[model samples]
Target: MEVRHKQATIDKLTHENATLKRLKFAAGREHFNAEQRRLLEDTLDADLQAVAWWC
Candidate 1:
């Protein structure tokens, strides 16, 4: 059903956001610089916003 599909989408987005947060906060990772960190945070925010809209 449409409701179930929307719920699935929201769940997926939530998991993605959580993973991103874990990555962003993990210590000793030299790959991401300050700018990249900001970008990642922005993306996580956007994902959360989309989830909110779905709700």
Candidate 2:
């Protein structure tokens, strides 16, 4: 039982680490120029604000 619990914990942590790595890769700015990145950020900010306001 103890071994199963530890293995479960390790598996969960490994999955979380892999998810974080994928998110980090996707969020990297290397694919965008500065202007494009700025535009995307501005659009995202506006969308977030709209969501907040709706909420």
Per candidate, the number of residue pairs that clash is 0, 0
- Worst 10-residue lDDT window, candidate 2: 46-55
Which digits, one per residue and each the tens of the lDDT, describe model 1 over residues 1-55? 9989888987888698678767957756557779987898798778778777776
Please, what is the TM-score per model? 0.61, 0.49
Give residue 12's error in model 2 in angstroms.
Answer: 0.1
Best candidate, lDDT-wise?
A: 1
Clashes counted in candidate 1 amount to 0
The C-alpha RMSD of each candidate to the native structure, in angstroms, is 2.6, 11.0
Q: State the TM-score for model 1.
A: 0.61
Reference-based lDDT, each prediction? 0.79, 0.63
Worst 10 residues of 1 by lDDT: 24-33
Model 2: per-residue Cα lDDT at residue 15: 60
Give residue 47's error in model 2 in angstroms: 26
Local error of candidate 1 at residue 35 (angstroms): 0.8
Model 1: per-residue Cα lDDT at residue 23: 90
lDDT of 2 by residue, 1-55 (tens): 8788677666655665575466469776446668976886686566556544543
